[model samples]
Structures are given as structure tokens and as C-alpha cells.
Target: MRTCMTVRHGAERRTLMMTGAKLVLMRHGQSLGNEANLFTGWNDLDLSANGHEEARRAGRLMRHHGFLFDAAHSSMLKRTIHTLHHCLDELDQSWLPEYRSWRLNERHYGALQGLNKDDTIARYGREQVQQWRRSFDVTPPAVKPDSPHHPGNDPRYASIPRCDLPCAESLAMTMKRVLPYWQDMLLPALRQGQSLLVITHGTVMRALIGHLDGLSPEETQTLEIPTGTPLVYEIDKAGAVHRIGYLLPPT
Candidate 1:
């Protein structure tokens, strides 16, 4: 049976289904870094041509499924921001309120930012690289504070505390930053019964999914999150969040 519930958006009120608040999580489409097989981290690269198409297709898929959102959130990175815009455009929801934060960014890769992944594997043994890439607590080497790859060098992060800036991060470290945003912002909004769209990076999305689904570190490491796919979840009244399915096949 279908039920309806009232949700508030600032001063505006919206009536939505009581099935539970729907939350959609998506990773940005292929970025230049991805196409070049580079360790992107938080380098803030733009999407490639194929990525643009992927974004549009993801949007169309959601629209075909009759998905609508009250608000959206994304990382401060342009790739995610652009993908969100493309998806919103296709859904005819360009006016939706958007919130962006650094906490939603990809794991900081430190000195690996522009290096080709294969080359890195060659320099560091495959097993070592794998550990850095897949281990829950093994962080990549830290970049020097003066390095161009460091977050401290970016003007966008000037307001952030100097101590909070990361030179490199493990999945565990990324989760530490991501969980706060979920607990402080997303969870409350979900409880308020507002449907939300979150466009973020692969590692950040994995961190979130790990928390929501209570996946172990090993399990999360093995999980592959495809880019440009919408992962839908329904939050019950008791505050449990579980996946419904992806809007597309998740290829």
C-alpha cells in the first residue's frame, strides 16, 4: 500500500510517499584521470567526452524510472559537480538545491595524483600497490605540504583548518571524514523524509555504502562501484538504510 508523508524544504513543504525516504548515490563518470589510468585522488580533473554521455544516460535512466529528488549533494570536485549538473538537466531538476563539500571527495592519493597506475605498480611491486589501493588502513605515501598535489595548495580549501587537510588517506581515513557528513546532514534529512541525490567519488561512495550496509573492510575493498550509475536506497522509519537496486544495470 502507498502512503504519503509531508517533508519540509526550508520554508516550502512537500508531500512525498511514506515508503521511506529515497536516497540515490552516484559516482561521477569517467574523468581525464580515469581515461589516462592515473591515480586521480582529489586532483579535480574534468570529465572526458564519454563521461559526459555517461552522465546524460544515467540521468535518462533515473527519469525513466520516475525518480525525483528534493535536493542533491556532491563533492567539491568539478567532475562530480559537472556530472550532477548533467544528470539534473536531463531530469529537468536543474533548480534543485545543491550542497558540496570536500568530505565527499575521492581519497587523497598524495604523490600518486598524476602518476599512471601501471607505472606506479611497476615502481612499487604489484602487491605493494594493491595494498595501498585496496587495504582499508594502508594509506599511500604522503605528499609534501608544499607539493602542488597537496590540498593545502588549493584555494578552495583555504577556509578549512590547516590540520584537517590531508596529504594522503586510507579508506579508513576517508571513512572518518565521510561519516561526519552523513551523520550531521544526510541522515537527518533522510529522517525528515526528504528524497536526496548524492553524486560523489568512488572511494567516498564506498565508504558510505560500507557504513549503511555494515560491510567489513575486506568486503568493501572487494566491492566495485561502477561509475555513472544510480544506487538507490530506502531509509525505513527505524532509520535503517538498505539498497533497493541500481537505476541501470550498473555496467
Candidate 2:
């Protein structure tokens, strides 16, 4: 089941058809746990059937908006890659080239990867879960070094420093991993007027947006950017601040 998406402030603003390319931050389709309300960080779960449909729907939504991504990027995770693939396919640009970087991945939840969000809420209490999910700092207890769940054994992360592997991350800590993409990859494209589409996790996106918008810790806590929504952005050459930030139709 897809969670209801909310595009809070875009409705009041008008979109510009400037010649410069902008970034489209897309949340990946509904995952199995997304329907069930679980924490999916770094678990590498496959997309559920309805999750695939959300990807298809996102593809249609992008095409309908008259936006074409020059190239795309996804997390190494399949949910994001598949979402991007599905969207590109619907755009009839499945053959278009793309890139993948771990910087765009969801915030790692360590030992919490396979846990149920609701049940965790029950055990930890709603406020604690909220803090874990929304709090900028305060990382949850990490997976033990010896646990099989530890990401150190994960082949995909073989190149990453073993010390950083299989650890927990707060939403604030997540930005440290995610922001580099903007610095190293995405920012240059925006400067060159190249349209880009990025499929990433919700908390990661929130961290990115939180950083960009200079959101307060309290404000970050209240912001509920939904999954599977299309966020269209326009930033200046320096990649400094949002010139025009809002969502598109069906927002």
C-alpha cells in the first residue's frame, strides 16, 4: 500500500519554464515494508508488486509534467534503481544513460533495518521513535560489530571503510553521507543547466532539503515530506539556495 503523499507548499507557487535544467528529487516507489510501515534502511529488499506500480505511476507523472531527465542517479539499493528504471521506461528513455552513488542512499538504521516501525514505536514509544526518525542528531543504537546483520559482510560495501560499515545513522548523520553527491555530482549538473532526476529515500531527502532550506531542528521534526512525490527544484549557479522550490501537479 502506498502512503498518502503530501506536497505541502508547492500549490501556492507558480512554476517557471526557464531554459536552465533543474533537479527532480523523487522518492522511490512503495516498498513491502512501506506498505506495512517498517524501517527499510540498507536492507536491500526487493520491490513489492505494488511498489513497482508506484514506480510506473511516478514514470507517468514525470512524463506528464513535460520534464525529461538528462541523466539519473540512484542509490545502490534496488528499490531506488528500479524506481528510476521504471520512471525512465515510462518516459520512453529507458535507454538513456545513468549513474549510481551510495551518497543518495537512505539513512542507515543499523540493527533497526529489519524492524517494524510500528512495533518499534510500541517498544520504544511514539516520541522516541519520532526522535529516532526525525531528530537531527542522536543516532539509534547501532548493530554490533559481530552481528550477521552488520553491513561489514555486505559485498557491495567492500570498498567502503569497514569502520563505517554496518553502523546506525541519525538523520543528521545521514546528511554527511548524502550531501557529498550534491557537492561532487549533482551540483555541477545544475550549474550546467542539465535536468536531473534523483530517486532516493524519504529521510535522506528530508536531510538534504533540511540542509538546503536551513530548517531548524524543530522544523525538521515537523516536516513530513512524503514518499513517491515529485519535488521540482531550481537553484542558482552556485547551488546555494532555492530560487523556486515546489512540487508539480498531483502534488
Candidate 3:
């Protein structure tokens, strides 16, 4: 049976009628980038055929275990958005409120956005590529303002100030931007006793999970969140968050 507890959200107090507030943090299913082993960043690729299956399986797994969510969120990229929709469809909760934001997009890979991983490593040396891919503060080379790979060139980001768009992002830089969304969006919802599903990109997931778990920089750098697997967390009575393990065995 679910337990209930009184929680305070600012001046207002609400009764949370469950064991605790739960959250599902999932990386989007395999995209064209994953299938091709390319640096996708915010390239907005579509899901591969296997990606669709993985997302559906995640949904089925959640459903089998009686997971329910009050709202869902994803990055502005289609791979994540489509993965979310597929999961929601399988959950039979297609009408759930959905929020999307560029803040949740993958860590911008700058000039490396479309390059194959192996080729990039071959050209740049594996150590350099590894540093760019895994270091907490080492940003990849920046894309020129006029480069097609830059987010500034994308119509969807036109409304955002040019200064807010990233040319490249280290894991630290990605975490900096992602934290605001957590404070301004997800935190408020969680305080209201809401169960949420957040489907986003791999690097973004690492950044977020790192912050949520209060990991050291070295630990965060090595963290790996598998695509399409749901990592669960719970907020305790005192509002401290704890990892509850993944819902299904990662494929």
C-alpha cells in the first residue's frame, strides 16, 4: 500500500499520497546518431527502427510495473520528443501534459556535431576525443557563428537570445544550463507531489543525474546512462532525492 505524508511547497502545504514523489529519468531511444556512432548533439535526428522498439519496450516495462506520471518532458530535439510520444502512447496516457525545451537538448558538440566517432578519434587522437566526450570541463571545439551546425542557424532557436545559444558545451557547461530547468520547472512540479517522466539525450541525462545525485566531478564524468532505459529516483519526506534503480534491465 502507498503511504501518505504532508509536504510543504513554500507557504502552501499539500498531502502527497504515495510512498514518496517519484521521477523517471530516461535517455531517448537510439537516434540516427547512435546508430551511426556520430556526435549528434542538437542535430535533431530521428529515431532508428531499433530506437522505436526500445522506447516501446520501456513503456511496456513501466506499464507492467504500474508506473504512472502526471506530466512528461523532453528536449526540443525530435528523437527525444518522438521517443516520449511512443512511450506515452504505450502507457495509454497520450493526453498527458508534455513540455519541451531547448535547455534539455543534448550537450552541443560544436564542430564535431555530424562527424563519425571513430573518424573523429582517428583525426584528433583518442585521448583528445575522449577528453572532449568525457571530461567535465573540457569543451569541444566551438562551431563558427555561420556554421550550419551552430544552433544560432536553426529557426527554432531564433527567439532565444544569441548569447544563450551554445557553440560548444563541456559537461560542466551543460550542467550549468540544465540546473536552472530543474530549479524552475521540475522541482516545482515535484514539490507539488507530481510524478514526472523526463526523456532526454545521453549527455544531458548524465549532467542531470550528476547534479541530482551530488556526485563528484570525476564520478559524474564517468557516469553513463543507457539509451531508452528508465532510471528512477524518489524524493523522501524531507525532500531529499534518492536513486531507486532502473525499471528494466538495460538492453
Per-model CA lDDT versus the true structure: 0.87, 0.76, 0.86
**Sorted by lDDT, highest first, which candidate order results?**
1, 3, 2
| Per-residue accuracy of model 2 over 1-251 as CA lDDT, tens digit each | 11122233545656445445667887888887687777888878767888898788878876766676678988989999989889898888887779987677788887777899989988999998877777788788788887766778777778889975538998777877888888789888877767788899888788778777788866765667666677766656766545354454564
Please give the clash total of every predicted structure, in order. Answer: 0, 0, 0
Candidate 3 on 1-251: residue-level lDDT in tens? 25333333335545444566788899999898999999999998999999999999888877766677899999999999999999998899999999999999999999999999999989999999999999999999999999998898999999999999999999999999898999899887887778899999888888888888898999999987788888777775456786666664323
Candidate 1 lDDT: 0.87
User: Which residue pairs in candidate 3 collide?
Assistant: none
List the candidates' TM-scores in order: 0.91, 0.88, 0.91
Using lDDT as the measure, name the better of candidate 1 and candidate 2: 1
- lDDT tens digits, residue span 1-251, model 1: 23333333335455444467888899999999999999999998999999998999989877766777889999999999999999999999999999999999999998888899999999999999998888999999999999988998899999999899899999999999999999999988988888899999999988998999889988887778889988777886667886665554322
lDDT of 2 at 133: 76
Error of 2 at 251 (Å): 12
Which of 2 and 3 is the better model by lDDT?
A: 3
Off by over 4 Å in 1: 1-18, 249-251
Q: Which stretches of candidate 3 lie over 4 Å from their true place?
A: 1-18, 249-251
Give the lowest summed-lDDT range of ten residues in model 3.
1-10
